[model samples]
Target: MTSISILKKWNPRPTSLSQMNALLLRIPVSSPSMSPRRYSTRDRELQSAKLEIENAPIIRNNPGLSASVFRNLSKFIRSYDLMDHMLKVYIYKEGEKPVFHQPLMRGIYASEGWFMKLVEGNRKFVVRDPKKAHLFYLPFDSHMLRLTLSGQNVKNGKKVLEKYLKSYVGLIARKYSFWNRTEGADHFLVACHDWVWFSCINLILMS
Candidate 1:
């Protein structure tokens, strides 16, 4: 199911290959389907990705890109395109502000906030249905959490963050069958905090 292979499965290929490519870009690797299995769409998407990666050609740059760099770079480029066309990300709606969806614009960690805002605002790669997404976004605003933690005891702050994340993830796991299906292999957390290592300790333990 490589993107190219998927395109070729149809009876009449589009006259404009580029247009077909563009349309394919909107087809996420995992999408809501009429299948009984939870991973039916995921499996299909994974097959497509695997085929696309395996079939990507190696572009020789002679003296330009080293062989190793070329291979890695090519893989990244091909994978990125496939992801753009087929990666569907779902942002969770649980939790309240100061920790949920608020973005911090004026700080070193603002990049994470900005990234979150952009993704949440961008509809091209986002879908309302969780079942249709390839990746699940745990939209915890670490920037806001940092601010709130500034006033709390250091040890207590860490525990608080861990508790919140555990609770949040637990809620999703219990309320929906997604986490239970894959053990959260499809879920991701977006963060730019220098302390992300410690902050994500809970996520690791739960995973």
Candidate 2:
């Protein structure tokens, strides 16, 4: 081939080893063929935000402020940016709707349901891939569980919910290594029912 033709076809390599190293660092984590070991840029930003929060002093507290409220506010301020930019929730896709994927958006339990839908709909924070998630949200609706138990003994209803949760957790543990790895430290659920909260005790202990 002519030199001009060769030049047109030729691909330039990194000028130096250092340049190559820098280029490699910028590679995206979503590359299908390669699993990157380093933290993503988003994760790095979150780490820096966390450090800033941890070191920040308690600023401008009112005399009426309760210690608990103050502590909560402090934490919120510190982590708000991190949560907005880096938080990723992975909602499991195993279960059927109205119990798993579907949540009631009206009535007393609406908050729980609305929150789930809101988070799931927010592309900024919702990541379908479990590998990319910061938290695993168990999308089971407590209100639906209660509804499922209508006309049954209240105690039996609790047992039914507990049983379902146990099986659900078992499925997750068997299907993925995430639950087993942290003993469920990274798993969480949102529910407004007292009974539902009580039913989760065993599930939490397994973590």
Weakest ten-residue segment in model 2 by summed lDDT? 29-38
**Root-mean-square deviation of each candidate, in angstroms?**
15.1, 21.8
lDDT of 1 by residue, 3-101 (tens): 234335644644675676678789776533322255467658877897888787775554554755443566666787898788888888887888888
- Model 2 scores a TM of 0.67
Q: CA lDDT, every prediction? A: 0.71, 0.70
Q: How many clashes show up per model? A: 3, 1
Which residue pairs in candidate 2 collide?
183-207
**Reference-based lDDT, residue 2, model 1:** 25
Off by over 4 Å in 1: 1-38, 62-71, 150-153, 202-207
Off by over 4 Å in 2: 1-49, 61-69, 72-75, 151-155
